[model samples]
Target: MFKEFKEFMMRGNVLDLAVGVVIGSAFTAIVTKVVEGLITPIVSLIVVLTTGKTS
Candidate 1:
């Protein structure tokens, strides 16, 4: 049972999956931050233009 487990972990597929998950998580965070940054400025500009007030 220990040998079987060891062999399974040693395979490339599991390692690749772990790497993919980590990279995907990082990519999601970066994209979310970038979108928020861009949207906030545009939305603020729109509000200021429409309301004629800067808050």
Candidate 2:
């Protein structure tokens, strides 16, 4: 039972899932930073220009 459990834990599919989770977390942080720091300000500026007030 221990050997079987170890094999299951070390399988390619399990490793792939771990790697995917890590990469997805990193990608979400990058996209969130870009949207907040760059896109949000630009959008706010455009909104102010069009409506005379910021959203």
Candidate 3:
């Protein structure tokens, strides 16, 4: 069972999928930060200016 599990993990497709998941998570984090740091503030400012309320 252990050897079979090891072999499964060692497969190229499994490794590639694992790497892709990690990279995708990292890219999501970067995009999230960009939106929070830049876009969110601009949107908030526009909303406050138009509606005269803070969200």
Top candidate when judged by lDDT against the true structure: 3
lDDT of 1 by residue, 18-43 (tens): 89999999999999998799988899
Please list the residue runs of candidate 3 whose C-alpha ends up more than 4 Å from where it truly belongs after superposition: 1-7
Please report, in order, the local distance difference test score of every candidate based on alpha carbons: 0.94, 0.95, 0.98
On residues 1-55, what C-alpha lDDT tens digit does candidate 3 reach at each position? 9999999999999999999999999999999999999999999999999999995
Model 2 misplaced regions, further than 4 Å: 1-3
By summed lDDT, the worst window of 10 consecutive residues in model 2 runs over 46-55
- lDDT score, candidate 2, position 30: 100
Q: What C-alpha lDDT, on a 0 to 100 scale, does residue 18 get in candidate 1?
A: 89
All candidates' TM-scores? 0.64, 0.82, 0.71
The lDDT ranking, best first, is 3, 2, 1
Q: Considering every candidate listed, which one attains the maximal TM-score?
A: 2
Residue lDDT tens for model 2, 1-55: 9999999989999999999999999999999999999999999999999999854
